[model samples]
Target: MDKERLPRWGWLLAGLFVAALVANLLNLFVLVPTVFPEEYRAVTVITTMSPVLIYVGVWYDEHRQHYWEQSGAHIAGDVLFVVTGAALGSAIVLVAIIDFGIPAFLREVLAMGAGFLMSWGLFWWRNPDVYADESAR
Candidate 1:
């Protein structure tokens, strides 16, 4: 990865985090407050889905080049990454709700954190050379 590309990747990660934060905020402040308590489950599903969707979209766009080179493995890895991230995030939310009795806002925050960590981990695993200097090329 070029030094120049590093900033782009950083910005992309930052944007994903910010988007997750905003989704959680909206879920906590607007959706939950305005909707019926019964619909809270639906709100939770939507908030959880948003980050995974963003991660998939960004990952696909960034790694499209590697798609053709290793189509089967790459696609499978992508699917696994999304599914694992979603499961991890959902588990965090469930645990927070059931075990900790944490508030909605804090639960959202934990979900976002889980999503961020999963996304970063997968991204790093997929792009191990991300920090390599590219000036020679």
Candidate 2:
């Protein structure tokens, strides 16, 4: 494992996280929302998936490769950190954008973008199970 690189599973998780983020942002921010749908349920679903994908990727990596021993309380900790960080980050930004009357697409982009970034940050900081090296960048 290299300190300068993310684990394979980490890369996969990051890819999914970015893909979802980009899809949601492009849907409303770049493309016409009406062309997709009146309701943004898909966007909501996508926004909320950041933590799940990260957790699954990390858990699967640990389970299959035995990178580290993370179970029970540790698993719960990861869930808590990732989910709370993303949720709170998204909520705070969402409220601010809604209050300021920002454009709908920008709101989605900002909120969901915050969520994904927070989720990734928390996971990277609080847990090193997904990192190949202790000095991971």
Candidate 3:
């Protein structure tokens, strides 16, 4: 893939990651306190899991068609992408908050955006044909 086109996927993935981060943040900061109120145990569980479900669903939707090969290696690589991206993104946010005194919200947004870009780049590099239609750009 051309270096110039790489930014397109970077931005796209960053946007998705930020959306996931925002959903999770909203659940923690607002929905849990106001909408779900801790008094209801089932509501709490639902609220806690909703953001994760949303993120996974969105991620799968974004890649499902491109990665429909169903090969073991493809599945394993996709899983690795999720695990590594989440781990690295969390670490980045934690370090920024603790060491730089950045707000958690800002750190999370930045970390997830960067994580998605990096992870997507790796994924795209591994599967160049996924975005073979450069002419569409």
Candidate 4:
């Protein structure tokens, strides 16, 4: 369907998913590792970026007029999504910190896979059609 026809809340979730995936990957792989080796400082970046991503996602959702009125569930879901992303990034760091338990290539793969699965599950569970249908009933 076209942009106008897309459900407002669905679009909002979609945008958040995309932003979280991009930001988490870029920061975890490229930015953090490049700037601050594998110390506590690097893990700090991974954990801290989660809330930052959520805030930025919310700000973009507001400016973009994506979702319907903000709801408690939406905010909760956003937090969940960000936490999942942060955990994935942190897992990679753990692998590196523990003597490269996970190979370099596998770390990137795991991060992307986790991001996709988390986003997909959250979006599926909170689908806008289900919300609308329930309200109509």
Residue-by-residue lDDT tens digits, candidate 1, 15-43:
55675576567767876678635323433
**Which lDDT tens digits does candidate 4 get at residues 27-133?**
67776778755433334434444454344434444343444466978867766765665656556645554566666555555554544455444544554433243
Candidate order, lDDT descending: 2, 1, 4, 3
The residue pairs that clash in candidate 3, if any, are: none
Pick by TM-score: 3 or 4, better one:
3
lDDT scores in order: 0.55, 0.64, 0.51, 0.53
Instruction: Please give, for residues 1-137, the per-residue lDDT of candidate 3 as tens digits.
Output: 23354454564565556655665677588877777443222222222223343334334444435456669887677557644655455445445555676665665556556555555555556666665665753
| lDDT, model 3, position 14 | 56
Model 1 / residue 85 / CA error / Å: 2.7
**Model 3 misplaced regions, further than 4 Å:** 1-66, 134-137
User: Candidate 3: lDDT of 17?
Assistant: 64
Best by lDDT: 2
- Candidate 4 worst ten-residue window by lDDT: 39-48
Candidate 3 or 2, higher lDDT: 2
How would you encode candidate 2's per-residue C-alpha lDDT over 1-137 as one tens digit per residue? 45238766676666677766766677667544556453343345444577566755554554434524657787678678877777677767776667676777888778778887887888788765566574553
Better of 1 and 4 by TM-score: 1
Pairs of residues at least 3 apart in sequence or in different chains that clash in candidate 2: none
- Tell me the spans in candidate 1 whose CA falls farther than 4 Å from its real position: 1-68, 130-137
Model 3 global lDDT (CA atoms, 0 to 1) = 0.51
lDDT of 3 at 2: 35
